[model samples]
Target: MNPPDVAAAVVVGGLFAAGCYLLLQRTLMRLLFGFLLLGHATNLLLLIAAGSPGAPPIIGAARIGDEPSADPLPQAMALTAIVITFALTIFLLSLVYRSRQLHGNDEVRDDAEDRRLAENQQREASAAAADPHRTNGSGQARTAADEGGNTL
Candidate 1:
């Protein structure tokens, strides 16, 4: 392939990789940046998929039987995507701002119930370690206290 096409492909790959990495972060700001990168990558891919640039679709721009006219559909779709991405970006930014204001940080918080469950598991583990004969919620012994839940 040509140098330009190769460069574009590399850029698209880099954007996808960076976007995915940022998307996995805990902060809303990074997530926003990730989404933007992903959106741009998508737009570029759409343009590339639409084929090489050609003359504008205007009448008389290209001879009737000569050079081909550009396809308007991909251009329209890309434009629509850009607008939607902009609107969503604004909405997400406002959400992130409000989250920071309310929580004093932009990091995504863990669910309260999940935290409580993890704590409960930790406590249960410590308790079982302390008492070898203790049984858990499922009526199974923490140690080798019984076999098949029955004693001979």
Candidate 2:
């Protein structure tokens, strides 16, 4: 590959890695930025995959197989990706604004049910630790299901 192609590849890789890292963050703004980076990376990747740009594919502009013609599909796909990304940006911005207005923050919150389940598990662990006979005859740790045979 040429120097420019190598640079583009490195940049695309960097953008994708950064995008994934930002997406893992627990904030709406970061998530939005991550998506933007990913979109850009995708466009770059498509452009690179389309190969070096050449003469326009105009009808009768050139003899067949005389000169390499630019691929139209990659450009079209990139344009479509841009439009979709723009729509997603608008939607995310509106969502962030709504979240700020309602909750005063864009931080993603965990579900209440998940917190409750964690608390229950902690309580069960503590109770088992405090009980001398909590273990079964085989010295295996007993679970909530074993005690009451109840499935929540």
Candidate 3:
């Protein structure tokens, strides 16, 4: 490959890494920017997949033994990706706007449900450790001291 292609690939890789780091941040603005970077990287990667450029994909424009016309498929795919990225970017922007309006910042708050589920998992793990023979997720088994109509 040419130096330019190699350099472009390197840039794409950098963008991907930065985008991923930003995506993992707790701030919505960072997330939005990260998403944009990833989208741009995707578009560039798609174009790169097309290899060397050629004459615009004009049917019957190529002469005998001449360089083939550029592939239209990758160009079309890039366009589609751009549109999808644009739409998602707008959606993310709106979400950031709403978050700012409600919370005066773009930071994502901890979800109560997520916390509850984590706590439940921790409890279950402890219970299982306490009872190695327990087969069910509840980590409880029938005992002589317990009286009930059903296991429930």
The candidate that wins on TM-score is 1
Q: In model 2, where is the ten-residue run with the lowest total lDDT?
A: 137-146
* Reference-based lDDT, residue 7, model 3: 82
Prediction 3 global C-alpha lDDT: 0.81
Q: Cα lDDT of all candidates, in order?
A: 0.79, 0.82, 0.81
**TM-scores of all candidate predictions against the true structure:** 0.74, 0.71, 0.69
Tell me which of candidates 1 and 3 scores higher on TM-score. Answer: 1
The count of residue-pair clashes in candidate 1 stands at 0
Instruction: For residue 138, give model 2's deviation from the true position in Å.
Output: 26
**Model 2 regions lying over 4 Å from their true place:** 1-4, 60-67, 121-152
What tens-digit string does per-residue lDDT give for candidate 1 at 70-146? 78788899999999999999999999999999999999887666655555566567767787575653244323333
Candidate 1 error regions (>4 Å): 1-4, 61-66, 125-152
Question: Per-residue lDDT of 1-152 in model 2, one digit per residue for the tens?
Answer: 53458888999999999999999999999999999999999999999988887788677775567677889889989999999999989999999999989999999987666755665566667667778575552233235434433333
Tens-place lDDT per residue, model 3, 1-152, is: 54458888999999999999999999999999999999999899999998888778877665546767788899999999999999989998998999999999989987766655565566667768877677674534222112221222
Q: Of 1 and 2, which scores higher on TM-score?
A: 1
